[model samples]
Target: MPASAPAQPIKLVIWDLDDTFWRGTLSEGSVEALAENLQLVRDTAARGLVHTIVSKNDFAPAEARLRELGIWELFVFARISWQPKGPIIKELLSQMQLRAANALFLDDNPANRAEAQFYNPELRVADPTELPQLVPLLRASGQPDPTLARLAQYKLLERQQQARTQYDDNLAFLRDAQVQVEFREGPAAVLPDLGRLEELINRSNQLNFTKRRVTLPELEASLRDPTRRWGTVRVHDRFGDYGLVGIYCLNEAENRLEQLVFSCRILHLGIEQFTYAHLGFPVLAVQGDVATELNQTEKPDWITVQAASAATETPAVVATPTGQQLRVLLKGGCDLGQLTPFLQAFDLDVAEEFNFNNEHQIPVHLEHTLLLRATREWPAAEQQRLAAALPFLGREAFDTRLWEPGYDVLVYSPLMDYTQPLYCERATGRRVPFGAYQDITAEPPAALAARYAQRRFQGMSEGFLQRFAREFEHEGPISPAEFQQNLQWLRAQVPAHVPIFLLSGAEIDVPGSGETGARQRHELMNQALAEFVASAENCFLLDVRAFVQTPADVTNNLRHYHRRHYRALAQQLAQAIGAWQGQGLGHSPWADLKARAVGLLPAKLRGLLGR
Candidate 1:
C-alpha cells in the first residue's frame, strides 16, 4: 500500500493442472504419461518464471507423481495437499515470501483462474500447455535469467525419490485420510464468491467434473432461462474448503430433458447430475400427461403413463470415475473380439451385454460377454460419439465390448457407463516403437515369461514388432461441438445413467513458440481437449507420450507386458463405474489385485489409499 515500497519483483509462476495447462486429470495415468508437458516447464522456468504446482490432492501422491514424472524441480514450491488451492496458493506466496504483485498464478480450472483473478487481478493466469508461447508473452520485452535451466537435472532426482516411496502403503494412507464432500441444491445466487469458485474449479478434481465453463454472469443468465433448469452443488468438509463445486444445466422440451451436464467436481456427492435427472423426470411426466390430454386416444404402444413407477426407478444413469452422471441414456461402445481375451487375462467371465427383465424387475447391469458374433458396423453417430470422448475412451468403449454393428459386438448396456477404460489405442501418425509390452495373466510371471520365450522363438522366424512401430502424429484437435453432440446421443440411449470418458494427446515439435505438432496452434488442441473431457464425469485425456498405454490382449502388443499393469487398470475402471453401485464390474480379480498391491505398502500409506 505504500508508494515508497519498491514493488516485489515478479518471481514465480503457479501452475494448476486439469483444464489450465493440459486437459483432464493427470492422476488418471502412470508417471510416464503424467509428464507430457515436461519440456515446456523446463524451458519456461529457464526464462526466469519460477514454477509451482497448487492442487488439492494429498501431499504424498502428488509429490510422488511429480517425482515419478521427473518434473518436480521445475516447481519452486508445490502445495499438493487436500486444502483448498486458493488459500494454499496465497500461503504459497507467503511461504515463498513473495507478494501477489510479484507472482503470476496459473491454473487450468476456470474457477481457479477466475478466483485467482478475483483475489489478485494482476496475477498471470495460464494453462500449463500454453507455457511455450506464454513465456514469450511474459518476457516479450526483454532477456530472462537462465538459472532455472540448471534445475532440470534435479528433477530426475525428485523422480527417483518418488519411485522409492510409491509402494509404501498407498491404500491405508488414503483410507485413513478421506475427503468427504457434501453437496446441496440452491439457486444460482448461492454460488461461491469468485475466488472460492475459482479454487474449487482448479483444485477440485476427482468429482463435480464438467467441461462447459460459463462466466459468472453467463452462468446466472443460463440459470434464469425459462425453459432451462439449473442447480448448484456446494462442497464443504474437512480439507480446507471447496465452496460451490458443481453446476448442472438442462433444457426441457415437450417432455424430454435435453442438454444435461454438470461440473465434474461434485460428482461423488450425487448432487449435480442426480439433481438434473430428477428435474428431467418431472418434465417427462408432464409430457405424458399433455399427450394424454391432447389425444384422448388410447395409450400408444410402449408402456406409458407409469408415472409413479418411473419415480421409483431411475433405469439409466451414466458416470465416469469423476462422479458426474448424464441425465440421458447412452449406449456404451462394444468390441466383442477384444472383450474375451481381455477378460480372460483377468480370469473373469463377461456377458455379451445386458438385458433388463423390466417385468421381472432386474436391476440394470452391464453384463459381460463370453464371445464375439457376426461383425456389425457401428452407427456413424456412435463412432463419432467416442472419437469425441478422446483420452477417456477406455477398453470398455474401445476394446471388444464396443460394437461396430455387424463388424463388432451386438450386446448393449442399459446406461452407457464408462468411468474407467482398460486401454485406449491410437495409430501413431509417425514412425517406429522402441518396445511394446504383451499382456500375460492367469499364470505366474515366470510361466508367463516362458510363454513369451516360446512366442519369441516363433516370432524370431517372423521379426521383432516394435521395430516397425513409431511415434503417433497429429489427427488435429477434437471439437467441443463434437463432444456436445456426443453427450446428446448418450442421453438418447436410455435412462440417463451413463457417464462419458474423453482422451486427448499433444505432440510438441519445437517446444516454445506456442505452435507445435501438426496444426501448430498450441493452446487450441489442449484447450479443446480440456473442454471435451470436462464436459463429462471423471473424463480423461491422456498425453500420447505421457502415459504408457496398457493393451487389453497380449497379442495386441508383441511384447506381452500385461500382468504387472493390466490388472490395475481393470480395477480403476471398475471402481470408476462402481461409483454407481449397480454397474461396473468387470470382475473381482482386478479389484483384488489392486487391493493386494496397496496392501503391500506400509499401513500408514495404505490407510491413505483408495481405488
Candidate 2:
C-alpha cells in the first residue's frame, strides 16, 4: 500500500496571474478580478498565512491592477515578471527564509505546476479551483493565526523602518514614535484567548522562551488554575495600536517564568527588556534558538524598568471631571492631625486618630491599650510596669472603629519617642517641657524636674533600648531589618494599591537653649525616615518639616503646620491628584489629537465631524 501524503504546514501560498488568480488575464483581457478571490486572499492571510502573486505579465500594469483592486499591500514579497514560475517561487521562498516543504504553489496551467513540483518535489501543487477546498484542509493544525492583525502591525513597522533613516540613532526613531506599553495581570489578563496564545507560542521561533505548545483546552485549564499567574500586554504608539501583542505565564508560588512569547512584529522595540523590568523579574536564560540570538545582541539601555515606587513628582496627567478622593489615614505625629483640615479642604477623606483629645495626643490608657494589642510577648516585670501605668493612663484605646482597612493613603509617623515608658508624659500625668523629657530618672518619670536630671546622660534618655528589648523580645534598638518587617506587616493589612505617605517628624528645638544634642537626634530621626521610605514599595516620604522650616504667621509651633500654609499644602495635594488622573485611559494620544483637531474646526465643520 502507498503511504498517504504528509500533512504539511503552509507558510506561504503563491497565486498564478493568467487564469488562476482572477477571472481574466491582465494584458489581453479586462483587468477584472473576482472580489471573492480577493477576499479569500485577505481571509487566508489573516489566518497567519503569507500570500503573494507569481504572474507572467508586464510588472507595472499587473501591479496597478492589483492596487486598483485595493489588495496590493496584502501580498507580501510579490514577484510579477515574465520569468518561469518555478524559479520565481524558489527565489521568493529563499528570501523569506522558508522551506519548500512548508509552501504551496497554485496555477491554472498543468505545465507550470508540474515544472514547480519537478524543481522542488516537496512543494505541493494545486489547481486554482482547488484552493477554495485546499485552504481549509491546510489549516488543520489549529495554531493561532495573527496574520489578519499583522497587516496593520506590518504597516506601522514599515513606517517605523522608514522613519529610522531620518535619524542617526535607532533610539531616536523609537522615541520619536512615542510608544506606550501597558502590562496587565491577575483577573484582568486575557487568558481566555487560548488559540491566540497557542499560535503565539508556536509561531515564535526566536523569542519563545519555553518553546512548549499547549492546546486551547489545556490553556483554558491553566487560566482556571489558581496556582498559575498570567499576564498580557498591549502596545500603542503615535502610528497605531497593537492590541494584545504579548502573553506571559508564571508559577505563582515559585515566581518562575513558565512561558514568554511576543509577536515578531514588535521585536525591534526591545519589549522583552521592558517586560522583565516592569514585572521585576530577571531573564530566565532559556535555551531556545531565538533566545540564543537575542542574547548575542547588545543589551538595550533605552528601555527603562518601570518605577517601583508609585509616586511621580510631576506626572503629565490630564484633568478629569471628578477629583481623586483619597482616604488619608493620619497615623503619625500631631503635625498630621493639624494637616487634616487642609487635606479636607482639597476634598480628601480624613480619618484621624480615634478616641483622642483635641491636642491629638493619645491618653495614657489609650496608649496602654494600643501597646497591649501590639505586644506579642513581654517579660513579667515589663507587663507589670504597663499594668501599673494603666490606672494613670486614659481609658480609650484610640478608637478601633477608626482603624478600617482600604485607606488610599496612610500618613505614618509613628511616635518612636512617645512609646518609651520614662518619656511618656501623657501616662505619668506631668507635662514636662518637650526638651526636658530626655532627663527622666533611672526609674519611670514621677515629676517634671526628674526628667531634667535624666537628660544628664550622654546616651538615649529613656533607656528605651533595654525596655524595648524586654517588651518586644528583641535584642536591640529598632534595626532596619525590624523596620522593614514592620512595613511589610503594615502593607499586608491594607490593599496592595494603597500608597503610604510617611510623614517625617519636625526638627526639635530646646525652647530656652540651643542644644546640639536635640538637633542631632532630630537629624538622626529624619535620616532613618528617609531610609525607611527608600526600602519600601508604594511608600512616599512627605516631609512635614519641608512645610515648617519657618513658622507661619498663625502659629509659632514647629511640629505642625499653621493655617497660613494650608493653601500651599492644598496645591501640592491637587497636583498629586491631577498627576494620577492624567495617567488614566483619557490620556490616550488619539484622544488628545482628536480634541486638539476638533478645537481648531468651526462649529459647522465640527457638526459634520460629530461623534
Candidate 3:
C-alpha cells in the first residue's frame, strides 16, 4: 500500500495577485500567470493549506483570471478590494478560524505587506518570491498539519452567513451552529497535551482573567491545591473538532478566578461561555486593565452569574479629621519601625513627645510576664524588682487606676512575639534568654488591666486606655484565640471616633530545616489569623499578605523585614492610610488647588489641553 501524503501544519497561505502571483495586473493589461506560482497554490492547497487571495483589482477581472487558470476553487477565500489589505486579511483569518500568527501573508508590494503586518503584527509576512525559502522554514516548525479542516469550517461559516436574512446577527448563527463542548474538570491528565494548557493561558490576551503566566511547576502546584479546581474545555461542532481550546483555574476558598484563558482561534465559538458555565460562571468584577474577549467581541447571554446574595457588601467609609498630624503609636516586634519613614512623609508622627503620655516600651515576651507580675503571680524576688521599678500601679497599688499613653493611632503586631523567643544581649556580647512562654496559660480578661501601669507612675498623662489602637497583625506563627477576644476589648476601650487599623500579615516563610509539624502549625495560624482580621467589625484590616511573595521579598528571617523592604511596605501603608484618612497622606493646600484646577475642565478638553 502506498503511503498517504503528510498533512501540512500551515493553515492558510495568502497570495497577492497583482505583479506578485502573475507577471502584471490583469486590469492594466493581459497578465501572465507564473506556472510555479500557480503550482505553489495548488500544491499548498493539496497539502491541506487554505490558499487565499488578497489583491487590489476589480473582483470580476481577478475571478476571471483565476478561472482561466482553473485555480479559483482552490482559494477558499479571495478579496479583490480597494480597501487596505491588513483589515481584509484579518477578516479572512477570522473567517477561517485560524490564528494570524500561524498564517503566511505573501505580497510583492512592500506597502501592502506593511499594511497587513501593521493590522496584526503576529502575521508571518513574506514576498511571493520568498516562497522557495519559506517552505522549508514552515516545515521546520514540526507541527502535524491537519489537512483542510479549517477550509471546511470556513465553508460552514460562509453557508451560515448566506442563509441569514439580516446582517450582523451573529447570535442567531451561533445558536444554530449546533456547537458541542466537552468540559473536563481536574488535573493535567485530562488534557491531551499538558503544556498546551500553560501555553494557552500565557498566550491568550482578550480572554485572560488574571493574566498570570505560570511555569509547569506552578501549574502542578495549583492543581495540587485542595481548594482549587482545574478545568479544560474541548469544543467541536458538526463542522469540526476545535480541539482543547480553553483552560481555567478557580480558587474555591477565595472565590477567585485565576488564569482563565482560551485560544483566540476559537474566539466567536462560545467555548469561553461553555467553560465558565461548567464552573458556575462567576460575576466578573473588573480589576485594573483587563481586556477580556467579552470586552472586545459581542457579549453573550450564556455567562454563568453568581447568586445575588453572594455579592460582596461595600464597607462603610470612616470619617477622619483633616489637617492634624496623624499621631501613630508603634507596637509589634520590629517591622513597625520600618513604617517610620513612610509615616513621617505623610505627617504621621511617631516620636516619644507625640506618643501617648506615660507610654513605656516593654519587651513582647514580658507582656505575659507583666500579666504575671500585675496579678502577683510572679516569684518574690521578681515581684519586688517589678514593684520597685513600677510602684504606682500593681495589685496592691491603687483603685480604678489607668495606664495613660496618649496617642491618636496605635500600630502593634504580635507576629514576632508568637513566632520566636525573646532575648536581651549584654554589653559583653553575652546573650540572656527570655523564656518563649509557650507553656504560659491563657490569662483571664480582668488580669491585663495594668499592662501599661509601669508608665503611669512617671507622671505622664492622657487616655491610659482609650487611645485608638492600630495594629499590623501580619502573619503570626501561633493562633491564640484569646488574642482575638482581646482585640474586641481593646476596641471597646477606645473612643468611637478612634480607628483600629488591623493591617494583615504577609506569607513570610520559606522552606527551611524545620519540623514538619511546626510548618503545619504556621500555615494553619496564618489562615486563621486572616479570617480573624477580616471578621473584625471595629477594626480596619489591611491584608498585606497579597504583597508577600517569596520570603526574601519582605524578610530575611521570615519574621522581621530588612530596611530594603520598607519601600514596598511604605507604599502599601501609604495607600492603606490614605483610604483610612479619606484622602491622600501628603494632601497639601497646593496639591488640592492643582487637583481642583484639573477637575474643572471637561474630560475631552482636559485631554486636548494636556496635563
lDDT of 2 by residue, 310-406 (tens): 2122122222246546566766444444455445545556676532332223222232222423433344555455444332222232234324654
Per-prediction TM-score to the true structure, in the order listed: 0.25, 0.41, 0.37
Candidate 2 runs further than 4 Å off = 1-6, 29-36, 42-50, 67-77, 81-102, 108-123, 127-150, 154-182, 189-206, 213-230, 235-240, 250-255, 267-270, 273-298, 302-320, 323-611
The lDDT of model 2 is 0.54
* Ranking of candidates on lDDT, top first: 2, 3, 1
TM-score, structure 1 vs. true: 0.25
Arranged by TM-score, best first: 2, 3, 1
The sequence of per-residue lDDT tens digits that candidate 1 reaches over residues 1-611 is 12122244445667665555345565675323434366656655544456777875566766766677677756755667656666677666554434577666666566776776676655656655555555455553212224232233224323332343554764333333233333322332222122223333443323322434444335434544677655444433222223334544456555443322333322223334344444444332221111012112232121112221122221233223453331211222232222233333332333444223222121222321111111123554654453343211222332343432221111232111111111222442211111112222222545544544564322211122222112132222223333333433432332233333232222233323222232233234334344433333323322222222323322232112234333433333333333333344445456565655664677578657631
Error of 3 at 26 (Å): 5.6
Candidate 1 CA-lDDT value: 0.38
lDDT of candidate model 3 versus the reference: 0.52
lDDT of each: 0.38, 0.54, 0.52
lDDT tens per residue, model 3, 515-557:
2343344444444444344333334444344345566664344
Residue 469 miss distance in model 2 (angstroms): 88
Backbone clash total for model 3 is 11
